[model samples]
Target: MSNKLSIVVVEPDRERAILIVDSLRAAGDFDVSVISEVTGLARHVSSRDPDVVLVDLTSPSRDILEELTLASGPLDRPVAMFVDRSDDSLTKAAIEAGVSAYVVDGLRADRIKPIMDAAIARFHMFHRMRLELETTKRALEERKVIDRAKGLLMKARGLDEEAAYALLRKTAMDQGRKVVDVAEALVTAAGLLS
Candidate 1:
C-alpha cells in the first residue's frame, strides 16, 4: 500500500473547508477527503479509515463533541478541532471526549499542517502510554495472583515462601504452562474447595 497519510476534514462551511483542504494538500503527499455533513460522521470515518480527522466548526455543541469522540476515540484516529471561540469548560469537555487537539480562533492555512502533525503525534504518544498502562496493570494482577497462590502453598504444605515459589515453578514447568496460568489454576481450585 502507499505510505501516504490519509486525512478527513469535516467542515460545515464549503468555502472555509476548501481552505483547510487546500492547505493539507500542500503539506505533503496526503489523501484527503472533506465531508460537509455532520450526521453519521463516525460511520463515514470508519469506512474511510483516515489517519487523521480535522473538524472545523463555528461553535461545537455537546452532541457534535460526542460525535467527534465516537469517530476518533473508537476508531483510534487523531483529530484536530478548530473553532471560532471556546471557553475553558468546553475545552475540558473536548479533551475528556478524546479530542487530540482543540484549537480556538486559530484556523490559519499555514498552521493546519503543524496542528495536524501535532494531533497525530499526540495521539500516538497517548496510545503508547495507554498500552503501557494496560500491560503494567496486567503484570500487577498476575503478581497478586502468584503471591496469593504462594501463600496458599505455604499455609497448606508448611513450606517457606521461597520453597512455595519453587514448587509452583516446578509444577508450571512440568505442565509446560506459564507461571501465571498455574497460579490462576491453583487459586481457582483453592477457592472452589473452600
Candidate 2:
C-alpha cells in the first residue's frame, strides 16, 4: 500500500555507501538499505525485495559482475551500476547482466534522481518487450497446433479446411474451452492413436 520506492545500495566502502544513501534520501522520500559486503549479495538483495538496486563499485571483477547478475533476479527490477572506470568487456558484461543504467564515472548526488529514473524507465521498456515476445511466441505455437489439428480433421473426416476449423470452434464453444485447448487435445489424442 506504500508508494515509497524501496532501494538497495550495494557498495563495499562504508563511507561511500553512506554517501549514496544520503544522496538517495536527498533525491526523494525513498526507503533505502545499503549492503557493504559482496558475499552472498544475491541472498541479501532477494531478502530485501527492493524496487530498484544501485551498485557502486570502484573496480568490478568478473565474479562481482556474476554476483550482480544473480542479484538482479532475472531482470525483476531495475539496477543501476556506477563504476569509476570500465572497459568494453566490463560494460558489455554489465549490460548483459541486466543493469539498466550503467554509468561510468557519473555517480554524483545531483545525478542520482535522473539516473534512477532512466534505469526504471529502461527496465519497464525491456520488461514490456519481453512480455510481448513471449505472447507472440505462445500465439505462434498455438497457431501451429491448431493447424495440425485441422490437418488431422481434414484427412480423417474428408472435410475442407474451413469445415475442419468450424468443427473445432464449435466443439470448443460447446466444451467452454479455448479453440487452442481443444486443438491441442485433438493433436495429442491423434498422436497417441498413431
Candidate 3:
C-alpha cells in the first residue's frame, strides 16, 4: 500500500525517454518504468497496470494511436500524450480516444509534475462521469422494465397504473425482493408467454 503513483512511459526516443523517466522520479514519489521499445507496448503497459501512462512521440501514426486507444479503453487508467506536432483532427481523435491529457510541443521536465497532476485529475473526472452515466442508464432500464410490466398488468387484469405498481410493490415485499427485481421477473414471464 505504497502512496506512490505508478507511471509507465512509452517514448521511442531513448534520450527523451530517459529525461521523462528522470523527470517523473524527481517530481515526486513515483514508481516509473520506461518502455523504449514500441512493439507490443500496449500489452506491456497493461501488464504493468500503472496509475498513469505517458507517451512522448515525435510524430505518432494512426496505428499507434489506435493501439493506445485500445489500451486505454474499458480497463483504462490516465493517459498523457505529448507530441511534437499535431493537427486538429489528430487532437480531436486523441480526446475521443480517451486521452486524459494531450499536450502538443509541451514536453519539459519542469512542467511534467503539473501536467501529470492535471492528467490524473482529468482521468478521475472522466471516470466519475462514466459511472454517473452507467447509473443513469441502469435506472432508465429498470424504469422501462417496470413500466412495461405495469402495462402488461393493466392490459391483462384491467388494473390502473397505480394498482399495477402497488401489486408489484406488494409482491416484492412479500417475496423479500426489490420492486425492480419483481418487475423484471414479471416482464420476463410475460415475454415468454407472449
lDDT, candidate 2, residue 10?
70
Best candidate (score: TM-score): 2
The positional error of residue 16 in candidate 3, measured at the CA in angstroms, is 24
**lDDT for position 172 in model 2:** 100
List candidate 2 stretches off by more than 4 Å.
1-111
| Model 1 error, position 30 (Å) | 20
The TM-score between candidate 2 and the true structure equals 0.49
Query: What's the ranking of the predictions by TM-score, best on top?
Result: 2, 3, 1
Better of 2 and 3 by lDDT: 2
* lDDT (10s digit) by residue, model 3, range 104-187: 223444444454654344434545676899999999999999999899999999999999999999999999999999999999
* Residue ranges of candidate 3 with Cα displaced over 4 Å: 1-111
lDDT for every model? 0.64, 0.65, 0.64
Tens-place lDDT digits, model 2, residues 46-154: 5676665665323362245444433344644433354333445444544554443332233343444444644444434545677899999999999999999999999
Worst 10 residues of 1 by lDDT: 97-106
Worst 10 residues of 2 by lDDT: 100-109
TM-score of each: 0.48, 0.49, 0.48
